[model samples]
Target: MLLFVRTAEAGKYKQSPPDGIEPSTLRLTAARSNQLSYGGTSTFLSIIVQIAQYNLISPLQIPESRILVIGLDDAGKTTLTQRILQHMGQPSKTTIMSTVGLETYEFKDKIAKDKSTYKLFDLGGSGRFRSLWEVYASDATHIIIVIDSTDKGRIFVIRDEIQTMITKIKRANQKILVLANKSDLPNAVTHDKIVNACKFDGVLREFQIRGLNCSALQDTDIEAVVDFVKSK
Candidate 1:
């Protein structure tokens, strides 16, 4: 049981508890009957009292979504992430280096109508930095694979890296979005070709995977990425 004090009243003789307080407890008094009485019969007298307004407040709760951005070196992972952030109406640094370990950004998803926060984790995609990516794999709600669509010569290398990474993802609800970036380049291959090269059907047994053609440098198809994120 809790007692809440309402607004303070000055000089007035009447006593009343403000709204929201339990009315049953309003009859309780601090002084004994005899002390509050004069002579044989009891005497009632109203006094000045200061009452503060207060009410119980409930704890707040908000939901968050996590997306991990990864792929081969020079695949434009950071560029793609920043482009997505910009598309989401968030301000992101225009120039960024290849992430040595990890980079993060957050934004609100107004389209969802749930006021959900979207967090993107951009991890270095080089061979030496691949170890760091594993540490965060299990915690990600979704994965974004950025591939340089014009780098056809390294298709097998990218496939090997993707296969190795997908093998460790164990979450049933974790989804994957492969962005075939730099698709505007003259030598860029089709997104379907890149998807086939990754062999996601064979590598990912429990996760949902989809591929999209994009040119992050040109700010193209970024909405498709956000749409995929909002799907969850």
Candidate 2:
């Protein structure tokens, strides 16, 4: 899950760091260039260009991993996906249309000597689209299943769907990250209450799915979900 990608100057270019140059050195060079470029001026521009020519050889880089986001409709999977993208500085055009089948976004991150890239699969979350999930389910390295924390009426259906889907996949190595989403809602179900109602504890024991409570709109809360997926 911890994919190590080397940072290259150009987009899509990848390579390992040179033997002598540490990643910190490369980051420092980039930071200096950014600082110099902050206040645009002819003199400052020329000086920064000269400094960049001498010290900065490439762009800042880091390593990243992939995760698949899935759940029932209106459970905020798409919103969460966009939030994660924004967190990685790759915000895209916002829209409210339903995902036809599957959508993907790549997040590139800089970490130490390596640049990591995470491919996030934001799959459609409606029951009618469940059939399409199997095609990509096997390909996902990690799975995040988001449940509407306030939807007490649909708990049984949600639980059944999760169990059935995992049963169909039957991949022992596939890591599952469950999100009790919509926690910020006034009537949102408590994490323990949801787990009990859905019998997730029993299902987790049987299927071994990892579950957590989070509000995707909150960056701090969502970070835990990101960390869990990346841990794979």
Candidate 3:
């Protein structure tokens, strides 16, 4: 026998973060249809349950965690994003020009039998767009700061940006992942060196920054990024 099921809904949903965290408002509007064939009564009932799962699941759905990646031009921000996506089996087209403004990459993953979506915002690192970085960073659950390990001259510039972002958020709970990129370069600075150069030695009250060596071009240490996200 042939069976066709169609479902549609439009409404507002509010997702509350863990205790002591702020809540977020989300509007969900979706419509879907599924066509299936049933060989027996048992099979038909199972299909019905599967089709009806959407409505039941939507209300209990977990909100996606937002991740922001920011850095100076030529810091390999975009390259790191592209490589991570590619490693996730979602490769995208590469561009040479620096990001003009804001770009987003979103995907879903299942961990420990729970499924959740993630949104990654890649903001342009040029002087013109740097001003807007804080706006996006404020809402992100985690932030990734990419740095050009070989460009020792930009250490101060990079340090200022990171500090400025922290000051803007004014939150001690912010989770920051610093990627000292271009680790494959012979002259690339070590992660420890990058951390020290950035003056991260100072006490950062509530905000936290963790630095890691990565080479986007060589696809090195990409798992560290994945592990960090999963930990969240």
Best by lDDT: 1
Better of 2 and 3 by TM-score: 3
TM-score of 2: 0.64
Residue 38 alpha-carbon offset, candidate 3, angstroms:
58
Query: Candidate 2: deviation at residue 144, Å?
Result: 0.6
For 1-232, candidate 2 gives per-residue lDDT tens digits of: 1112212342222233456753323322121222222223223332222121113334333223547677888888888887666655676647645454456665564322225667777777666666545434554567787888888788777788777776666454667777888888788876677778877777767444776787876643877776665664
Location of the lowest summed lDDT over 10 successive residues in candidate 3: 47-56
Q: Which wins on TM-score, candidate 1 or candidate 2? A: 1
Q: Give candidate 2 regions above 4 Å deviation.
A: 1-65, 110-114, 206-208, 218-220
The TM-score values for the models, in the order shown, are: 0.69, 0.64, 0.69
Compared with the true structure, what per-residue lDDT tens digits does model 1 show for residues 1-232?
A: 2333222232112323466654212222121111222232334422211111222322232125778888888999988888777767778776865665456566785444547777677877767767545545655678888888888888778778777766764554778887889988999987788777767667775678888998888888888988887676
Model 3 global lDDT (CA atoms, 0 to 1): 0.64
Clash-forming residue pairs, model 1: 5-52, 6-51, 6-52, 8-51
Q: What is residue 72's positional error in candidate 2, in angstroms? A: 0.9
